[model samples]
Target: MRFRNLLLSAATCAAISLSASADLTGKVTFSGKAPEPKQIDMSGVKECADKHPDPVFEQTLVVGEKGELANVVVSIKAEDSPDLKGEPSKDPAVLDQKGCMYEPHVLAMCVGQPLVVKNDDEFLHNVHSLAQENPNFNFGQPNKDDGKTVDQAPKTKEYIRIKCDVHPWMSAYIAVFENPYFAVTGEDGTYAIKGLPDGDYTVQFWHEKLASTPVEAKVTIKDGKGELNHEFKAEGAMAPDTSDVKLASMTKTSEKSCCEMSKKVEKVATATPAAKPADAQVKAAN
Candidate 1:
């Protein structure tokens, strides 16, 4: 009886150890020279233009002075790790529109995660998503403090494009994953994904400018710690958005009432420039 009890205790300890989670630290650095900032003509929207006394540069390819690449999404491709699936966080994923730009520029969230979109700008803005895997959504937030909670969670791993129909320059991307092991690189190009069980994982790094890059790495974690580092070539790699926004062609979808905005948005999207390729469309940097 004593021997059996000891064995049972050992098994319990082993099980507890196996269920422990770890932290994964990563950084995405840019190689070669940083790209020149592209100027955005915000004149079309006086409200947005007035906010910027000088020129407002595009964020399509933001690189730090020391080669730090911002807005790069780093996520674990846990296709084989069924047990590593994490429960969706009760806190909703936030996407804010301020100063005529999407804050964070790139957002990564877990599948089935709630999304909260807020318009912090005084000017009217619309949140329109060009989502393929998930059902599409388009809504207008006219009031400065207006915010809408997107109750439905995305059911698939996809990169959804969020745009403002009223301000064509306003764009952002949301990448959803099966698990919570994802992080968006900050301005310093550093990211950390925590709460990963000990195992092998395929980490995928994605950026709007480096859409074609096979930015993936395989790493094995043990003792609750792992590190990943990736570098993207910045020489002629920054894909700036020089496309012209023909406001004349894009009527004021925001002006329409909530009931009629959806119909007008559909008409406006059809007239916009042909969408970039699927991978390229994952995010809009500029």
Candidate 2:
């Protein structure tokens, strides 16, 4: 009993230490001009007909000349980061379905934490996480007013697509990072991470739309506080509004690509995957 108590105490401390935050913030902007969407009229169109009548190419938002960037997934391995906060985040992540749209369209919740799946919609909907990084959950929510919570296995992922089968059009992505130090850009394009221990480390920048060459960067960071600006030039990157946001950069030291998960983390991945990206139509970064 004493040993068990000691183990529990150690786990609790690790959880709290991992939950500590280090303030780091910045903006992601594009150099090229933002393309204006050309709305095409399909007055006379039919595919699925009664089920799916007028299908419009959803307008996507991308980084522009002024550079509006958000949802750049960042991750760093504990080995790559010396004296780093190696423990994962214990906070619960909320993914709510309301009015056929997923709130917090892009999320960066840590693994092993409770993922709160909410449904405020008036219709029955199911959550199907097309996941490879974590154990997949594909259950229906027959009730609308109330919702359910699910536990997610621990794993490092680029991003996983989630949707409601009943409402085919509804979609969202949960970008899970093994490291606790990850944040999603906001509307104005600003991100801040704090409470970091002093040491050398590498940080990554991942954009869903804009594809940068390096995929990730190798940097030696000292403790205290530091700043680095990462600009994703639209001209060189994938059109934000058109294609599936591809990989940008990573902090991997080996020859693997920036988007590739390190072997240390990949060993924890789920063996089988469930669904793929919905519609083959990619959603733009928020």
Candidate 3:
């Protein structure tokens, strides 16, 4: 009986040790004044323009009134962190297109995790991926609530750019990491990376406008928690041009009409028979 009690106690202690982990939390702030957001012109597409009664501005740099910076990618460097085993989550990260713009200007996901691109608009929008390390994909979504699951996940770590060819001003970024210790700053500029083992790590903070320069910080995690705060200088930072100078005139064909035409063409092609070879035709005639 005494030996049995000792074994049970050992097992319990091992389980508790295995589950010991910590979280890294931080906030990113802007130091100087931010640039004025550029207003986007959606007059070329009347349907899209009508959806927004007020003017929409570019999201290149979103800073709150209190200098909270949003859309910054925060992650722990893979080299400083231990390797993660097993597969990533099967649940997909979703990116939605609404009001002629991409929601959540920045997205972060573990390598090999699934991704779903959704269209919440009633008009046509093409998803074009400008990926250097991963395969590029471009497809059109013409109906409302159209969702497409990407065939494969990114195999390498990279920052992929997504764009809508139809909408010249539509753009977003996707940050892929080998490890799962990454988070994007929200409107409040806060982020938390959970489940990190107790150790020293190097954290990285990246922004789109500040692509040329990324800030790094060293942090030591103990006792299940670590806190970090960084401030980005905003001087000489320029926002991207959001004007629709290259927008063409709107097309007359509606989404429904276009879809119906495509279905009819596909059905006709499948039902049609192939022509006989010329030699067989000549033999039959003879």
Q: Pick the candidate with the highest lDDT.
A: 3
Cα displacement (Å) at residue 201, model 2: 2.0
The number of clashing residue pairs in each candidate reads: 2, 23, 0
- Per residue, candidate 2 scores C-alpha lDDT tens digits across 1-286 of 3432332234311232333333344566655565664433433322212323444332234343456565565555444653343344455678887655577677777655557788775556788876654677888776664446785543654467676776655657677655566666775566765444433445566554543212444333333344444555444345334222232122112334434211111112121111221101111111
Instruction: Supply the global lDDT for candidate 2.
Output: 0.49
What TM-score fits each model?
0.74, 0.65, 0.75
| Whole-model Cα lDDT of every candidate shown, in order | 0.63, 0.49, 0.64
Cand. 3 Cα-lDDT: 0.64
Per-residue lDDT for 1-286 in model 3, tens only?
Answer: 3432332233210112324455677777776788777899999989889989999998878899998889988777776554433245577777899999998788787777788889999889998877766777788899886568888666767777778999888988788777777889999988877666655776766676643123455666656667766566565444343332211111111112111100011111122111211100000000
Candidate 1: tens digits of C-alpha lDDT, residues 53-125: 9888877778898988888887766664554555676667889999888986887777766788888897688
Error of 1 at 99 (Å): 1.5
Candidate 2 Cα deviation (angstroms), residue 260: 12
